[model samples]
Target chain A: MSIFINKQTRVLVQGITGKQGSFHTAQMLEYGTNIIAGVSPGKGGQNVEGVPVYDTVFAAIEEETVDASILFIPAPFARDAAFEALDAGVKLIVLIPEHIPLQDAMDIMAYAQKQNAVIVGPNTFGLVSSGSSKIGIMPNRYFVPGPVGIVSRSGTLCYEIVGHLTGNDIGTTTVVGLGGDRVVGLNFIDVLRRFEEDPETKTVILVGEIGGSSEEEAATFISSSMKKPVIAYLAGRSAPPGKRMGHAGAIIERGRGTFESKVKALNAAGVEVAGLPNEVPAMIKKILS
Target chain B: MKLYEYLGKKLFHRYDIPVPHSKIVESPEEAAEAAAELGDVVIKSQVLSGKRGKAGGIAFASNPGEARKEAERILNMRLNDLTVEKLLVEEKLQIEQELYLALTVDGALRCPVVLASLDGGMDVEEVAEGRMIKWPIDVSIGLQDYMTREICRRMGVSGALQKEFIKLLPKLYKMFRELDAELAEINPLALTPDGLVAADAKVTIDDDALYRHPQLPRVKEKTDLELKAEELDIAYVELDGNIAVMANGAGITMATLDMVQHYGGAAANFLDFGGGASVERTAQALELLLGTNPKVLLINIFGGITRCDIVAEGFVKVRESKGIDLPVSFRLVGTKEAEGRAILEKVGIKTFNSMDEAVRHAVDLTEAS
Candidate 1:
């Protein structure tokens, strides 16, 4: 069983009429995600890939049980879609829009907290719970059902690392992409806490990058409360300061959020950190053995 | 999207935030004219980067002649690899105190934050001396006057100064919101005989939110390579290393750079062909990376929204079109890996399933060459 989603998890698609929304909706259906309904403001009576569409999240929830909602709205309108999902009582919201205004991200964060909900990302690839269910854009073939839990700040980086693990016969219970935006909805600490509590997830693998203090914060939490053995792989060691490396959050500023700092913090917490993604599987095998 | 100092000050003036009268000048003669118009002015080199004062990009002029000389020297200065071509001539203020104030989003907190310090005109990172007071602003309610006063009190600000801070905080917060700025800072809000004035301005408009502000104060010029990358919708940054690294996602791209460096190879550039890029767009991304002329090219793609076969198609296209002879190594996994590898194999371009093998091979090639 996964921490957030599973086979029984009924999902709804927000902005389901848009190109990405429709495309991923079909993909999720193909993966057997229990998609209950869809939302696309004016396209209420229509259906996307056999999933019923409603005008608003509130209207969609009135008819079908939507435990989670995947938002494919544009960056400018992503905040409104998140609020709509929260107001409609959808507990888990996965935001797919990148380049969301910082102010809007902050508001979304505050509102999500107030509603006691989980918002994955404003620039994420979403999450998948291996063979049983998936709610994101990640290719399902790379993931297999197992005890290792993966949480990362990137999509392709997560894919690469998970592929290595799966190739080594290490499957994952769930893989979560926390997004690469500066102001993301959830941090490493939040996911780590959940992973620590999941009995099915025996060990955790954190895929981090340079930029924010989330990795440091996660390390702090692991040193204090985490009992599960965790392996970490941090990126951007050679990245120069003051230059944003692709991701808005992947920059070292004022000597803070450097690769050395993150590695030092993680190592201090007794978490074995790998220098590269491919080294993770061997380290994990060593830890398990 | 960092606004020049003169432009940032213009916005401060528009918002009724007190700032010295300033004029943008190109040459030393224009700077002298502007300095003469304003008495005993300061000539500041206009560059996109910060720490200008420490970099000698900021200088004071006692008179118009001195201003002209300062402009000549500053115009030829380079700070953080950016040449200063323009100068901001402004009337110098009689400062009684220099206070630090800024409004920016704290990524970890996931909220807007207001930072004020008694010590000013220095890097905020050096504010570990206990003079800095930070208050996280709730974006729902914004930076209220009460919150500003509370922050001022926490920063040991009192009397007329506290009142001025209370009045100024809202305007600064408004600028941060209305401009869609990622960072809005006044390094030294000087308190002088006239009033509280912004001694320096730094406003970085969110590149994604730039569409909202069409009539920006000035558009910072982009290099030809940067413009080309923008046209192709790929995140590209040119570096001074020997290995060209390309990946499908930002995190993976950065990790690839780090791995290349870890294996004793310096990456020449950082390029991420963001998710779901089409076959044609992927080809264009590869072509753009080829323009950097690195010793070795390393392509690591773990397809999610992006398809691995599409990336393979791009490699094939580049080889067929430009006929690349440089040492190239790639790792393809996830989303049609077999098909992607077959495409590469058909083109006689060997592919690796392991990122480590590919990175090590590329780094070894760079060393061998």
Candidate 2:
């Protein structure tokens, strides 16, 4: 019923031996994610959090039933790990690493797309299907099963949206953190399209920041194919030009990625735009009503 | 992560790229000496971030005395919040044509993207306004020899200069790769009255990639404000806004900062205390933030592995010890959330379960302030 992830998805963890990989793996497992197996070179034959570890993604695929793979590998090795999972027929993957060298990130994403795979983030904070599959590092307690689908560039802000939705008795069907990295594997438009098609996702909440034309692109897409009501909010409106906000990708450089331009673009596209984060829930409520 | 122009040019020169004769000056005497080294020199303020020229960081002096004055002025000034601790004085370039060339990772395509423009000597921003010769190169293929050649040819580089262009591209590309640079730019990659000389160079190394290349560049703690924040060892990213945020850990702190922006408020800084922030540390962190003269403060802490009691203890100490000199709002969740709230409430501040409420209150308070 939902897009990308739901109760049925069984995920695997790549690079499960590293500190971040193992820590998040344990957290996801504890959050009730079906982390079927873990993969790390030379860490095979060991068990973490009751999940079997394998040497490579291919090995992990063979040993366990996996619907998706979340990459926690270092940037240098992320390219090969992603390709390995894709080659082994991992249909869906999410990359949680940031600052991936641009070249490697592109080749793998292109390669994965050619293989008909869906990649979430290169510098992303994974996606979650409330109470079903927990990926990345989003707080589990903050999410509840609901009809709204949420996508954001900022992971921390997503909690605010989720908390808003939760406060209003609106729970997300799936919340996706696209990350604020400049060169990410997926953008808001990509995830929005998926949510648009999903039967369970009745409405969508998009959280964008003042950087890049990704929001503009998403707005254009929303004006056309987006059948569901989409309420969007963009952060950093007053951010000075060329001042990089907390996120790497959320910088206003040479007037390309400005909050004003994006707001105009989104407003022009017939999408109800919340001027600020606090107004998001009210806007969404207005759209639904 | 951003390299000063002089340092970037030094790396450029090491790769055999021709540049104006240059030396960095730490003192006004050295500045005069550097200007003396070149009959006519360009005194450029050494700041880490971009748009130095727009910030009046670059000044040209025809005489050593003028250059010394320019250097002296710059060294004491702050450009775009970056202090000019040094000046890069270089031989004045008789630039005939200023071309633009940069090798950067394209986010959309997830590959190395090369942008080239023929219009030279003007701000690259102006050329960016015009159409650019954009080529997206797959990393597996790397920078192809033919494309680099084609790019040079398109930019009207020819003869010995074309060959030099050919040589320059690959070497620069190699250096870019070797350094794990996120961005490498040769603005005014020029055909001078002399030859192909890089008028200016800028390179930003990926922080994540720094572990592999230890000597590349340490994350230099810049800015007196940032340095002061560093005294408390808080992860702080200063913003142009009037609202300050102090939270534990990079991730949550970033979230709180973003939330501020989301709710139509700007965060003055991104300060992360990491996991398990003690009361002493929290007070010091608060003290550092107080220096920012924030209209209001929003402190969001999620204590899981780091206990809420510890965070509560920190909050109480910051208030009891520092006497709450600033207008602030706080949110404490997970692991003794109740206790965290109780401690804050006793100090006349309230905690919220919803970030929406905390952010709204903080934004309104700051706006009112």
Candidate 3:
């Protein structure tokens, strides 16, 4: 029992003929994701790693049941691919492209909302439901079935933290990447709501970074409503203002989204904020004990 | 990519928004010549930063001679670390009223928002909430006629003035949409004796969207090392600290920096080579990090798609190519970690599996130094 995706969830791949698409498709298949069809515009009638390909998402959906769609299209073409999937009624979209235009991201988020769908990232590493299904680019060995639900904005940071957890004999139920862009699809609150409802998830770990009011907003939700204990680790405390720190959304603008503000919010909400990445697994152990 | 004032006005003028007649000048002679033609002009230093007025980057000249002096003074001035090299000499308008109009993305609303305030000529962030009207624009429908009319009415704008606003707002919204701008601002949309004119223009295009809008000017406001990092396609930001930090992801890199500070060590710079970084790219990133000449170097990599062995080989390659004497704390984990550690070991470089241990070691080295 996992949130968003599992072994029974049939998936579709957009831009499946591309280098990243083909590689990840094989990786997803290896991890036992139920991939049914692929979309590559002109590469219909072809197969990638035994999954059938179609010219369009509509064409692919016509033949196979695509519960979710993972896009490997580049940033410029990501919007169109996402729209194609949404128009075909694919509810869960994993957008795996970086440097997507901010306008395109806004439109994608708005359109996805209108269609009652959820998009994981436009600049993301996607999500994995730990031993059940892997839709993202995270290494499979780092994740195993466990009680902790992990949601994060940064991909590699999430992986590194997950490695700490798995290495310490802690497993996760699902790991969702919210993307490291100014505008992303699913945020901390969105994932936290799911984690709170999941019986398998007894504790939640939020991996947030500087920039944007998402973490502060998530803290508000957690304090008012959440029953399960949550731990948070925020990055970019040492970053200077007005400089973009790798991620487009990871900058402190106009004194908002600073590390102090986020840590204050999370702490005020009764969530333990880890000072270092390695401190997380120990904190989780204490909470569960 | 924040455009200079002159460039923003150029975009505004191209999109049919009304602006003061202006000529961009580089030298004091050109400023005098432009002022003579325009009459009673304002000499504005064309820079990417705001608060130009506070920085003494703006001056009014009643005559051409004054304009030349003002230009000469401004040209030598550095506003917010940016030297003023160009001036936008424009006709100073007789202002009847001032208003604020801007179209910017609202992260919370997840869409473009039009911010209108009758109280202008100051930072909108400082403006009282009640005085400002924020209308979130749905990207699907865009800025509609009704929305603009409502905004104008709320600001007590009517008659011919309302008509001017009705005509102007859409054009501004069009420029915002077409240019893929993060912010399109008119801080003082002055009601002049001639007509409504933009007193100042602030336009910032999305850096990610710059590839599509190649015609736009690229402002160089970065340090030499930052520019070099840009050319090498590595994410790097220099800080005034001792330990130089490098990692695989933006979050991890930032976290590495935070940890260095947490353990009472200041980080010299932030460098992330991004995921699946090739050995060559890794070597280049390492070389760039070393260029900072920090007291200690901390490399934290949790390879997922980015292999540990690849990153290790990059360290070995850099060590073989250029001799390194600095204390280096390298943490390698995930995907072929043993092989990566083995490669580093061959070069007498010790690798740690724990990020905390590696960061503490680096901080200790910096402190010891």
Q: In order of the candidates, what TM-score does chain B achieve?
A: 0.95, 0.76, 0.97
**lDDT tens digits, residues B75-129, model 1?**
8877767888889898989999888989888988888888888888878877775
True contacts kept of 2: 0.23
Candidate 3 local distance difference test against the native? 0.91
Q: Which pairs of residues clash in candidate 2, taking residues 3 or more apart in a chain or in different chains?
A: A106-B110, A146-A171, A183-B107, A277-B262, A277-B263, B98-B120, B249-B274, B279-B314
Q: Stretches of candidate 3 above 4 Å error?
A: none
DockQ of each: 0.82, 0.35, 0.85
Q: Distance from true position, residue A57, model 1, in Å?
A: 1.2
lDDT of each: 0.88, 0.77, 0.91
Off by over 4 Å in 1: none
lDDT of 2 by residue, B209-281 (tens): 6667777646474778777765565667778788888775443565566678767888888777655566677
| Candidate 1 residue pairs in clash (backbone atoms < 3 Å) | none
> If scored against the real structure, what TM-score would every candidate get?
0.97, 0.85, 0.97
Candidate 2's displacement at residue A48, Å, is 3.2
lDDT of 1 by residue, A45-65 (tens): 999999999999989888988
